[model samples]
Structures are given as C-alpha cells and as structure tokens.
Target chain A: MATYTRKNAWNQNGTFSNSDLLWYAKGVRAMQARALNDQASWWFFAAIHNEYLSGQTTFPGWAYISAPPAVPTSPLPSQSIRDKFWNQCQHQSWYFEPWHRGYLIAIEAQIRAIVIGLGGPNDWSLPYWNYFGPGNQYKIPPAFTQLTLPDGSPNPLFVKARYGPRNNGDIYIPLPPVSQDCQRNTIYTGSNAVTPNPGYGGPSTGFSNAGSVSGNLENNPHNMVHTYIGGSITSTDYGLMSDPGTAALDPIFYLHHCNIDRMWASWNAAGNANPTSTNWLKGPAATGGRKFVMPMPSSRAGWVYTPNDMKSLSQLNYVYDNLSTGITKQLVGSLAQRLTKLGVNLIQTQPQPDENMDMGGNSEMVGANEGALTLKNSGARTAVRFQKEAWAKVPKSLMNASVTKVPDHVYLQLENVKGKMDSNVLAVSVNHKLAGHVSLFGLRKASSNDGHHGGAGLTFILDITNLVDELHLNNALDADSLDVTISPDNDIPNDEEITVGRVSLHRQPQS
Target chain B: MTAAERSRRSVSLLIFVLSATCWGLLLVKPAAVKHCFVTGGELSRTSLEILLLTNPISPMLAGWGLMVLAMMLPKLIIPIQYTCERSFKNRRFRAASLFVLGYMGVWMVVGALMIGGILGLTLFMPGSYTPAIVVGIIAAIWQFSPVKQQCLNRGHNHKALAAFGRAADYDSVLFGFEHAVWCVGSNWVLMLFPVLLPGGNNFVMLAVTLLMLSEHMEAPRTPRWRINLSSKLIRILFAQTSIRLARS
Candidate 1:
C-alpha cells in the first residue's frame, strides 16, 4: 500500500484545494443515504465512536438511530462486529490516542472507497483542522461554513445547529483555551496510584470510558475544541459536536480528530517516547480480554487491533503533511509575551525545565477545602488550608526555584466534578492568578462512573508551579490557606448542574 | 477537614464499631449468634410456640441488621462520600444518613428472602453439605458469567444529586436504593452460598465480605465469561509498601 499525506484543511501550505473537501462532502452524503442498519452507513460509523442516548427517538438537530437492529443485524458487519466494534471509542484512557487513530483510519478507508466510487483521486486523505496553525486558522474552515457547493447543491459538511460561543452559528475558537501545553509532558503514561501523575496521553487502565483523570492533551485542545465548536454552555440544545456520543455525527469532528492525531505524531517527532509496557502494547486484558475492533468497509471480517498495531502511521499507510506547526510554538510565543508584561529579564534568566513533568514518586496532598463547592454562573470561591504537618514531610526546597533544577510542582486538583451537561468551561485561578481552565466538554459521560473509574468522576490536575513561584516571590507562600476561584466563561443557568467534590492541592517532588 | 472528609471518617468509625461489636458477640456468645441463623430443620421439628419461645424474631432481625451494618457498610463508602459531598455542608449528615437507611432497607428485605430460601433448601435436604456445595458451585459459575459482570458494572453508576430540601433527601435515598439493587444482583449467589452452609457463622461471612469487596474494586470490562482475580486492594498495598520502602 502507498502512503498518503493528510494535509491541513485551511490549505495552510497551499497544497490542498476545495476539491478535496468537495469530494469528502460527496462521500459523506453518499454514506448518509444508506440505511441506519447498514454497517457502512454514516450513522453506523458515528455510533461506533459513541451513542449514549440510543433509546431516544429524536436527536434534536440530527438524524438518529432509535433502535439499531440486534446483533446479527447485518451480514456485512456480522454478529461479532456488532458485539465488539460499536460504541468503543476510548476516552479518558492511555489507549485514547491509538484507539482514535484506528477509528479515523477505518472511517477514512470507507470514505476513500466511496470517493473512488464517485470518480475521485485514489490518494485523497482526510484533511485535518489545525486551529493552532497560522493566521486566521482558528476560525472554522470556510468549506464547513458554506451553505451550498459550487454546483448549488446542499452542502453535507454544513450543519445549521452549530451554536459556538457567539451562538450565531459561527465557530470562532479562541486560541488561549486550546493550549498545546501537553507537548511539554515527558512521560508517555501517568499513574493515578497513591502519587498521581498526569501523563501526556492518560493514566494506565484496563478498558476505561471515563477514567479517573484525563491526560493533559485530552483535557485541553481536544476537549476545548469539542466544547467551543459544540455551542455555548447556556444553550438549550448544544450542537452534535458538544458530546462524544454525537460528536462524530458532525463532519468537522473527523478533521478535528485528525488534527489531534497529528499532535500525537508531532509530540513523537520531538523525541517523546510512547509506552513500552506489555499491558499498553497488548491492550487491556484479564479473563476474556479487550481488543480494538472495527468493521472493514469491504466484505471482510472486523479488523482487530492493539495499541502496537496503531503505533506507527507509516505502518498504517498515512502521514501528516506538516508536523512543525504544533501548539508548542504558539505556547512559547505566548509565554514570552506574558513574561515581558511581568518585567522579567529574558536575557539573564536560564532556560527552565519542562514545567509539566510527570514525576512518579510520593506526592503529598498538602491542602484541601472543607467541602465541595457548586460552581455557579457568576463564579465560586473556597479556601484550601495547607496542612502544617505536610510541609515538614517534603524537602525544604519545595517550590524554591533558585535552589533546584527539579523543584517540587504544586498542582491544583478538582476532584469528582459531576455535571448533567457538557460545553461548560471554567477558569480556575489560585489566589486570583489564572492557573488553568477546566473544560467540562464530556462531563456527562465522564461523570457516569458506572463503567470506568469507579465514580472517581473527572479529576483535573493543573500545574501551578509558576503561580507558586510568583506567590513565593511576594512572600505569599507561607499563608495558611490559598484562595481558589472557579469562574465559568459562559453563563450556566443551573447552579446545581455542576459541582466539584473537592478542591485540593498536592506537591509532587521530582524523582 | 471538610464536611465530606468528616462524613467519610464517621462512616469508617461506624463500620469499625459495628464490626467490633458483632465480632465480640460472636466470640462470647457463639450459640446465641448461631440462633440468629434461620434453618428449616429446627422450624419443622419444633412447635410454633416452642420456636417463638426459643428463637424470637426481634433478636434475629437485630442480629441480621447488625451483620449487614458490619459486612456491607464498608462497601458503600463511594456513594456515601458522594452523597455527603453533593449535599449542603450542614445537611451532609442527614443526606448520608438517608442514603444508609435506604441501602440497609433494601438489604434487610433481601436478607429476609434469603433466610426464607435457606430454610426451604435445608428443609428439603437436611443434615448434608451437598446443598451448600452445590450453591457454592453455582455462585462460582455466576462469578464468571456476563450478566453478573454487567451488574457489577452498573453498581459503579452515580448521578448528580439535588443540593437542597426534599429533592436532595429523595435523590440520596433513590441513589442508595439503585446502588443496592445492582449490588444485590451481582452478589446474590455469593451471599446465598454462606447462608446455605450448616454452620454459616461469622468466619464464613468475613471471607465472603472480602471476596465481594475485591470484586467491586476491579475496573469494569466487557461483559463476558472470564475469571476476575484482580485484587486492587493488594495492588494498593504493594504500591504503598514500595513507596514507603523507597522513601525510607
């Protein structure tokens, strides 16, 4: 098989054209016309990612399959395919990157076949929406926004329900929320053991849907994109892009995920390693075991895969057109601007170690709030009292930047965040300095602890080393308690809908 | 500490007290504790009046409820912690109390039915371990079954609770009941096995309790026929030991 290069959707390097998107739109339209029960239908492929509310008769703005035929539904998919492949999207797990890679390949193969049938080029690959690319790329591609094709036919890529931030059917994704800070993470896998480490991908687990905590990459740009493009948090019916179950139903979702896959490739190119563990390579196993399975577009059995099978894009017969324009470049530029505003001497300062280090050792919970705080439309605040005894347990050089190369990292953890809906993004700050934003994009699924992380709910650990450094510089580090504020970026009608079980702080010393 | 933390601590204390008291009673008065174990042979052999005079319903129910509090309350920390955390700080205790009441209420009803079933089985086949062994085998088979795994998976489910008034109370109780329903569905056979044994004493109960706790700790997987011996407790213990050793 010949390798194909997946280019940027916005025609960043001027290599891509309108015809690529036109052919993609045509393929999508052809797939949409198939029966809901058909294995190769657009609904079938989307359902494979997730179909949370499958029993519901209506899906608001989009077509829904109320009751997909039972196993042995279609001969093409077969009973085995229906049993294992549907609703198998790996979210909140280490397998997330690999699982989605296989999903995109399977869907792309189906679409490519359909495109070929419609007399399109054989080498056509899925174009990625690189919102972090260059000038004016943050906005939704014009092709997706267009109501009709050049031939004056209805555009399959265009959906009328997109209720992005403006709530005016425009998707202008803000650059700040979708930071590529995840590229700085050195470790491939993180542990939620006694000492929690937020890995670049996610924590190690055996087949997780909503694991304890999201890997830094999944938490940010990936989730941020999902929320903003979906709609405003306050909207009655957020678009198909809001929730994972309906996200793939939207045409832009594939391109969004294609860019996310490119991030993984870019991360690897920077010399970061993927996990070499047997558990990760072989997939989650116990008695019956679990494997990544997807229905092939042709007359063949379902394609069974492991993380090992998806470890290489070259092996999969595809490569990204460009890997140089990942989020790290934007992050560095933004950091320099922030530091300049703070009057830091850029020439004299030494290059600091990666702040987002996944230190695997004994991390202590140094402070916590007295009770859970229900985040509101206006905002919520709490005082996390530092345990006096905990300070003595760690190295005295904790958060002391001048004395150590690998100083202890102070992390703010929002534990067990439960919510009824998605598309809410909360700006979290420590002592009034903006630390990070918690994107509750898949709050519903992540909160449903039934099948995943044992009701741990969604835990977010934001690195606040720099914030702590500032606090130390001002002699504010010795205070008995730190004021933590959670303010929603968008208005949330129901205060009862979202609640953080606890606001705690931990200090992880470098190993 | 936070109200949620306080609530969890209190729950731990309650479990410890209940377990200690029950275990002490079992040690001091094994015969009296054994009387609480309902059996068909005694009911068929003795008159109703004699049975009432010897084995009273009040003590039996009390012993059974005490047993449940000791053996099962530990398994409910997640939902109880969640209930407390979700409620107003002042109402945390009330919310958790309601949840415990609702959980124990379901287990009480199920315990009565299980007692009745044990009586029937013992009546049909008296003075033999055959029935007990058969029930044990059935429980073992059910452990590997897909339906049982499905029930275990459902047991981890929790939902957003209302923060105020009767809605909060109702939601807490409803969550408790739902959790109990799934819990009983997954462990009914394992629970039934101990009751069927001739000397179904506290020792057997303790062993079964450990098994159930271990099973609950395992992450949910695809529902299929498979043996699940993954002990998260053991893993935690090992990890903690390593961390401590490395630190020292």
Candidate 2:
C-alpha cells in the first residue's frame, strides 16, 4: 500500500480549505461516537494520557501483558488493564524524537482506521498545524474555533478547556513563531543525559520524563506552543496545554505533536544521524534506556518498540506532503561548519580586551513599558529594556560586518540566568519592536559543575539576525544602537529575583 | 606532569593532608562530652558560666572546628579547585589559602553565635528538652521549605575569578564567603540536628554529613510539599555508590 501523506493544515493558501475542515470535523465526530470502551473511540485515545499521568504500575498482572494480542473480551479495561500501556514516552532523552514518532504513528493508525469506517478517504492521514509557517495560518484553524459545523452540528474539534483567547468566539491569539535557527542544531545528542545539546531532541533521561535538561526544539516550539495555546491567566495554575500530564486532553495536542514529529522527520532527512549506540537502540526499559512499550487497545495488546523501528516514516506507511528538510539541512550544515572553524580561531587568537567599564552597570529591574513599543502585561508579560548606549562599546566596523554576512547569525546572549523556570515565555524585542521569544518549558537549572554554568548561571542564546533587518537597522552607517528589551509572557513574583549576569551581543560566522 | 597539573596536584595534596589531620582528630575524640556544654542540650548555670568564661578556642571549640573541617571541607573541593585554576601560576597556593580562610571565617562566626546562644539559653532557663524538641521540629519543617531550596540553589552559583594579582585574591575570598553563607543557610539546621539530639550521637553526625554531601551533588529540585525523606535519601545514596563503583 502507498504511504499516506500528512499535509499542512494551511496547505491551500494560508488556511485549511472548507472541505478539509469539514472532513476533519466529521472524522472527529465519528471517533467520538464510538463506545468509550472501543479502542477506536475518542475516550480510548484519551485514556492513554490518563495512564501516563498515573505513572508506571508495579502490579504483576499489569506488568506482564502480551504484545499485539488477539481481540480483547472487552475494550481493554480502562482501570484494570495491567501494565498493558503507557510504559514509555521519551522526554529528556536522545530517543525523544523516535519515541514520539512511534507514538504519533500509533494514534494516526487508530484514527485513520475509524475515519475510513465512517466513509472518509481510504488514505486519510493526520493534518499538521505548521504554526511556524508563514502568515495568519499560525492562528487556530477556523474549523477548530467554530462552535458548530456548517450543517449546525456541534464541532468535536472545538475544545472548551483551551486557552481563553482561543475559545472566546471572535478574539483569537496567533501562535508565536519559533526560530528556524533552533531547528538547525546539528548535534544529535550531548555528552551526558543532563547536558544541553544543539540537537533537535533532548539529553538522555529515564522513561516518559525529562532529565536535568531539555532539547532546543522541545523547549521552544514544542513547549512554547503549548503554553501560548494553553493561556497564562492564573500564576498558580498552568494551562491544560502547558502541563504534559493534561496536554493530550486538548484536541490541538495531537495536531501540535504531529507537527513536531514531522519536524523530526525533516531533521533526519537533512543529514543528521540518529544515535546508533546499543543503549539508545535497545537498552533496558527499566533503566530508561532503549525500547519503548506503548499499549494499543485497538490491537488488543501492548507493543514494545525501539528507535530503529520508527526511524523511517515509510516503515510506518507515512510521509509529509510538503517537506524540504534536505535543503535546510545543507544550508545549516555549511553555516555550522564555517562557524565552528571561526569560533576556534577567535578563541585562540583574540581575547576581548578589558574596556574598564563595570559590566553590571547596565542592570535594571523589569518594568512595564508603553508607546510605540507597547509592553503588554495582563498577567502574561515581564520585560526589561536595554538602552541604546549599551551597544556603544562594540566597534562600529565589527557590527556592520556581522550584519552584512549572509549566513552569520547575530544573537543576544543572556548569561548567568537565575530565576524560576516556571516564569513566562521569554521574548526579545529590538528597539521596542518585538523580535522573537524562547519558551522556558523544559529548561533545567544549570548545576554547579556544568561547563556552561561557569559559576554565574545558565546561558540562553537568542538569534536576533532577522530582527535587525525587520526593524530596518541593517543599513545605518554610523554606530547604530538598539534598545533590546527582554521580557516574559507572565508576571514573575516581585520577591523572586531573576537576574541575567550579562547580556552581550555576538555574531556567529556563516559560510 | 605539566606545570599547571603539578600545581593542581600540590594544592590537592595540601588540602587532603590538612583535611585528613582534622578528620583523624575528630574521629578519635570521646563520644560523650563531660565538661562540654552542648548547644540546645540540658544545661546547668555553673556549666553555662564556665563555657562563657573559657577562651573561645577551648577544647570544645577545637572539636567543633575539627568536625566542621572533616564534614564540610570535602564539599568544597570543586570550588577550591576552580579558584586554583583561575589564579596565577606563582600565586595559586596563596589564592587557595585566602579562599579557605574566607570560607572558614564564615563558619567560625556561625560557631561563635551558636555558642553564645547556647550560653544565653542555659543561663536563663532550667535544664529541659523543650528547646531541643522545638529545634528538631523546626529542622524537619525546614527540610521541605522553599527557603532551604533557594539557599541550596544559591550555594551552587559559581562566579568567574580574575586570573592574577589583588583582584584575583579579592574575588576568590569573596566567592568563598558568599558560597559559605549560602551553604550554611541551606544546611545549618541539618548540622544542628545532632547537636540538639539528646546525648549527641556521633552516627547521626556522620549521617547528616553524608546527607549534606549528597544534596550538594544533585541538581536543585522544584520545591514541593511532600517530603519522602527515606526514599529520596536512599536514592541519593544508591546513586553515589553507583558513581563510585563506575569510577573504580
């Protein structure tokens, strides 16, 4: 059978066409109508989430269920199914990408089977939101936002528990765009499970949970999207999407995860290699090594899977409709190689001279700002503004050279960060205008011995190359400075001090 | 060995020798104190007066200092090595010494305050277990408090050191003092547990030292209301043992 293709929700123009939307709504309604005990029912799909939240069980009966079993006497018992499922979901591990890939495939198969039974297209596949793609399509799809279908039946895709802005009739908040640069991280994994890597996946960790650190992609687009969609009104309560335990309950969860899985597939196609270590491919399940076991009620048995089994989308009978990950891979590879060489030379030959100025002189407490650069803080914003003079110390010639270089990425480095990880998503604005933001979801506090910790704190590097041009600061001849403002999406407690030891601007060389 | 490596070895040797001597003295000391006035212990007015009138560096104070050296100095290896690495080649020993001095200075002040507080308590009140029980409960409560976690987190913060001269000297000492204050804030209650325990058990002191060391080794955890004391401690112990075995 030909592999199914998962298309972007905004495959046509900038939004889901009326027909695609209709089919999706109908499929969801059909799945919801099935008996709660039915493996293909919406409730059955949701139970997988509940199992994960409850954590691993120790009961003998639950721990030893057979895999890919024959038809069950009753839809696998919701409460009684012994160790049948939810044993694996990779969080802060090298195998995060593959585990989630297998997970998405399992759900898609069940959903597709139901859709076909309801007379939908035989080759139907899950649709991705593609929130990082261009234009207003990043906003919640109209189909999901609508209270009822065109024929006036209640839309199953509409979830009431979503962020208020998303659920409230007309007023909608567009999903924030994640940096493409983060997706370009070349390393597959780091030295240890807890150390942060440039890879698309996180550091090594135990089953269904994150280690001390989170991967860049998982941290930003993956986590930030959840918080943004979940909303941030009450400081005490994280929105449904924000917390992993309840994230899947939201209808948008599957679609969002589908997009992440697609990105992983793209990352692989670009030229990076999945870990081939025995520990990664088939390590012991008890120690959170290799081998992911997920329960499949539709099949009436559990399935024990490995990264090797899920490495190829074709093996799972699926492909993305419009992915050009190869092109991105090549571009990023060349740029990264050039930067690595340049970095070595810079470190060896040139040490920055002391400017005799106190580095801490520029420190300021976060405050609300208005005017052309409107700093909105409705229980969801925390911002700090850096004056233009902060950049005066840098040589004008060097600054110009950094921007003119095509592939060279400029970054605002936040060093020695000390604050609660639960604070609002961090956004960077150039000269009062919004540039881009990074999600704090899954960020680990730097341990004392971590090389990156440097006794100060963890360092966060945000790419601001595109922001410079977008703000029309690219062509100024004289020493041009920017009022770079760093802000969070939610209010931090006044008593809690979130200090950035240093904020310096630097550029990475490109090929 | 390279000059840098040799310097590192010499510094480590010096630290190890000094620490071993203190620990040796501590291990050989009598388990029970006859004349010594234990902090928060049942006390008599005459014993309190004797403690107050004696020299600050009396045999009791010496024992306390030795205990601090043995239990706490092991935890300072990473920071000490870090300071040594950042100092000038000729002055590495000097920087390390100053850093140790600053760290010990903070602990000494804490020791003085503790002694003074005990003297005051003994002088004002009759011998009773009320203060000890209250302190024990407070220590248990603090184990699960957000303030304790914050102090522990702050203790892990490492700042960059200057490479040479007076600047390096000043920064090294300052960093040590800062780290010592946070460490004490994080672990003072645990340290006081044995002191307040009736008849001061040496095993409890040893257990508390192990706990302090293990907690410092792990990363900061999110503050939660639940305190699974035994399970967490067991996990840390197992992890430490496994690490040692792997290294061996």
Candidate 3:
C-alpha cells in the first residue's frame, strides 16, 4: 500500500514515493553503489551475460540457455614455428577477446531494463566492509546486490565466501553435492585419436595426466564458455510433466542468469582489452572452455579431464545490452567483498589489515617476500642452511600452471634469494585438480639449477585451484589445504623435503 | 453486441485512433513526442522541442504510443450520453464528423498529455515508480467516471452537434468512448507492473498477465465482468493510495 498518490508523490528530482519505494529504492542503490567500487570486474560480468542474452534469443540451446562454445579448426594459422609444442592443444584459440565483447554489451541491456522497470536509480555508493581492507583492494562499487541479509549475521557455509567481522561469523551456506541425476547431464565428449594442437600450443601429449582434466572435456575441441571456475547451465526441471522451457516456467532463472551473464560479459571485456600476450593463442585454452574435451597428454598418467571442452557464448540466445557506467556498480559491489577474502593481500605499504588493503594484511598467518624468498638458519647469522619446511598464507597470488585454476594447484617461486652459492633455495608445489583426491595433480619440475653455486635451489609452480573449485562444495575444506611437494634433487639442510620461505599475492586498484 | 465484434471494433478504433493521431498530430503539431524521450520533456518549447516538432516519426511513434488513451476514451465519453443526445436532432449527419473528430481530437490531446506526462515523470521525477504507476492506473480508471463520461459525451453531441447528425452520431459517440475505456482498463495493470519489476520481483508477472488478458478478452459481451473487474481494480488502487497516504 505504500505507493505514491496524486497529491504527495516524488519524481526523480523530488523526494516522492510511498514509504516502501524509499526502502526499495535504497536497496537498489546499495546494490549499485556496491558494484561501482570496481568497474572492470563488472564490465567483464556484463560481457558474459550479454553474450548469453544475444545467443539465447537467436540459436537457443536445450536445457541450458546457450549452445556450447564453438571450436573452429579450419581457421588455424599453420607455421613451422608452431611445431615446437605438443599435440594436445590443437583447438585452443576460441576463448579470446572481441568474442567476449558481444556477450558484455548484450547483458548490460538486460539489467538496465530491470533497473528501469524497478523505478530508476536512487543515488548510492558501493560500500567496502572494513573487515576486508580499507582501500583499493575491495573498492569495486557496482557489483553489490540488494542487501541479501543483514550485516554481521554468521554465514554458515563451508569453504566460506563470506567476508566480515574477522571471518568466524560469516561463511557461505554449505552446498549439497551435485545430485546423482545432475551429474548425468554433464556427460563429456573427448577425442584421443586427433591431437588438438600438434605444435602451436603447450604439451598435447599429457593434458589429462594425473587427474588434470575430465578426459572427455579436454578432448572436446569445442565449448568456449566452460571455465576454470564454474560449469554452464544444462537442461532444467526434467521432472516437469510437459516441457516448459518455451513456457517460461521458473522465469527467475533469467534474473539469476543475469548475474551469471554479467560475470561472463565482464570477463569478455577484460579479455578484449588484454588479449593473451606471447604464445597466448599459440596455446589451447588451459581450461576446457571452448571445447568439450581438451588433450591432456601429461595427465594421461593419472587423473585428468583429458579432452576438456567448454561451451560458447554465441550459443546463448540472449545478449547483454551495453549499459552506462552508472549502471554497473551494483554488480561490482557484490563481488568485491568475496574477492577481498579469496585473493591475496597485495598492499605494499603497512603490511597489516588497513582500510586501504585486504583485511589480513598484518597477520602472521601471511608472510612477505622481496621477490625470491630468503631462508636463514634458526641460530646462525650467515644463513648457511635452508630449513626443511617454511610456510605462509597466500589467498592472493599469481597461480602458476601450464593451465590455471587447476583447483589446489600451488607453485612456489624463490624470491629474495640471499645466500652462498652452495646454500640451497628450495621450491615446492602442490596440484590437487580434484577435491578429496590425492595430490596426483601436483607436479614438481625443478628450476634445473637452484642457486649460482648449483647446490640445488629448486623453483616449482603448482596449480591446485581445480581441486579447490570442485572439492570446495564439501564443508570440511579449509586453509588446511595442501598437496605441494618439494623436488627430490633440492638439498634443504634439514630433513623436510620442501620448504616455502615466503608468499605474496597480487590485486588491481579500485578505480 | 458480440464480444468478438466489440473486440474487432475496439481493435480497429485503437489502430485507427492511434494511426490517425500519429498522422494528425505529426502533420498539425508534434513537438511533444520528439524531445520528450531523450531530454525527457514533452511540454517544453525549447529549440530541442522545436527540433522534435520537425522530426516526423519522432513525434509520430511517440504520439502513436499514447493513443491508448483514445481506446478507453470512446467507451467512457462518446457512448451513453453524447450520441444519445445527438440522435434526437435532424442535423446529426453533419455533426457526426465534427463530433467524431472532436472526440478523437480530445483523446489525441490526452495521449499527448500522457506522452508529456511520461516525459515529465522521467525528467522531473528522476527514479520514482509510485507516481508513474499511480498516474497510469488513475488515467485507466478515470475513463469510467461520470464526469469523463459527460465531457466526452457532451462534446460529441453538443446542441449544435445533436442538431446535425441524429442517430448515427449517437452511435458514433457511444462506440467511440467504449473503444477508449476498454484499452485503458486492459493495459493499465500490465504497463504499471513494469514500473514495479525494478523495485521488487514479487509483483508476479504471470498473475498480472492473466488479469490483463481476461479483461482484454471480454470487453462488450461481458460489460458486467469489465465493470466488475474495473471496480475491483479501482478500489484496489485507491485502497493502495489511502494506505500510502496514511503512512505518509
């Protein structure tokens, strides 16, 4: 009943509205303000949604809203220089830039329509919880949502996406495992006979090595939208008596998808601006985004989605309508808080929880490295012996891998190497491509030469995000996360095989 | 009358009035629609407004979009009172054209008011939905008002008009407003809900869609239902208004 009336109503310029619109209006603004804190992230989200919107209205997929990502083989740029790489990376060029652009613009329009349909913008700014950091680390303004729950309520989910009040109180709702039937829908199709990229990309022979990828997924030479993070929407409500995808049952999917679509669009926009640098397209999509199955020759030894394939945005019938800068803030604000927690703290100044950096800045749980980590003996000043074990927290850090987001993949680099030639600098790595599984995904290839004296200073890059991403559905997971192994060749003065001296993470500024 | 016939006439009149309004307003005077959308102003007589007047479809589509007013106008204004008044005179023949044109003109002008009102809402109101929806719903139900009935009916069959076109003018006026009222009653809720979609997902699009189709499906054959449905809507709207008023 709190709607405006003839005599006392408000216009955009005036303070009009029945009381509820004021509150409702506030929620919308808050959503926007929260997003604006980081415009780049939201732009990427918008691109993904836009691509889906466009494709959904056009080609229309069954069950899922978009058709799988397309993989084109005929367009290959063949050359003698490409032959150096292995065969598994044949069809890996689809998940690049301008393609992501189409998706970004389309979804922007969808959310805008929702905004206009609501009422319009009430002025608001994205707010960063002091719980994360004070400054640039958590400043994206536009990704905020209508305040879902009151602040300070303890979120009880495992692998916690929640951020605020020092982490204990806020966590995500523990997710149920994918139902037996749901897994059936994710049937993968990969090929072994055809080597994907003969020479252009990375190792084609060992793609599925040691649980690297879903064999069929990596082998599938198509499906671009599947990602390092999440899966694509498949069919819906199979239990319905009569199919109603056309009937528009559960229309709420559109709005939820608007968020998903927005994420993809934002990613696409970023991809457009920063196309992979060297050997970018020369390699296959590290993740099985564009194709159903990727060629994982290395992982054939243990576990891997050898032929990993992903879906394409064009297959989606819908696209995002490009929106004004003012509109994307709600989306940004929502994501910023989550990123603050998962991403490592990178503020260079005072290394503690400050308003300007991530919340965990100063905790002993996290350590810093000037570059190559330095190790000193417990009692000795000359730092002659490297310890068997060293550790620090790294929620934010560059994931090193032939392919990133391989769940729990951890790669250690030796920064601030201050020691004698024979003094050892040890590098360690852990790769857990799937959860609850052993570190079969972990690979340890030393830097070949550890120190100048060649006493054995090893440098290894590990990627285990895939394990984290998949197993994360289980509540038991925590910072107790590990797999990472040290090289057998490296000589740590002590009995422990691997020692991590320092850890650091990186993040962008909040413009 | 058959509901189908009424629907057909209703649709034709809606299209006719809309097309006529577009053709007429653009040819005669149409500064309202052009500048209204971009600058979000309709009544302003600025150079931007003048530019709009010169642009054809700018005002044409704008004018057409609002002729929804004319659909409900005929049912409320030209019907019961005006044409009956015209039927009694011998000069009713000449008066039919004048009256129909006048009646059509009145709705067209009203359309402009709405087009202008929408412009005003976007420009002046900024981001308020309550006012826009309230206005749309009110404009929708107001067609049933006795006063609106009198103005539309009387203007169509003034003493001079009544003296000119006898029975035909009587039918024309009666037929005219019936056209207008039906449209306003049917489209009001659907259009109004979009204004709410942004604020809350709870508005329930499916329920609202059904209500609108039900109203549109039975305009003449089930005048009772239309009246019943409209009365309920009118009451609900004002009931909402009163509560809001109390809160404010």
Best candidate according to lDDT: 1
Q: Of 2 and 3, which scores higher on lDDT?
A: 2
lDDT of 2: 0.54
Across B68-167, the per-residue lDDT of candidate 3 in tens digits comes to 3323333333232323222322333344444455445545555555555554454445445566467447745653444333332222211211112134
Q: Give each prediction's DockQ, rounded to 2 decimals.
A: 0.13, 0.08, 0.00
DockQ of 3: 0.00
Q: Lowest summed-lDDT stretch of 10 residues in model 2 chain A?
A: A356-365
- Give the clashing pairs for model 2: A62-A82, A62-A83, A380-A489, A380-A490, A381-A489, A455-B158
lDDT of 2 by residue, B1-248 (tens): 11223444565677778777776776677543122235342345556446565523465556666777877876786677656544434565787788888888898788767655655655654355665678779888988786777676666666645433466678778988988898899788777666554455467777887778656654443334435242334553454465457659
RMSD to the native, candidate 3?
A: 34.7
Clash counts for the predictions, in order = 1, 6, 232
Please give the lDDT score at residue A461 for candidate 2.
53
Best by TM-score: 1
* Docking category of candidate 1: incorrect
Among all windows of 10 consecutive residues in model 1 chain A, the one with the lowest summed lDDT is: A65-74
TM-score on B-chain, cand. 1: 0.84
Error of 1 at B7 (Å): 24
Quote the positional error of residue A363 for candidate 3 in Å: 98
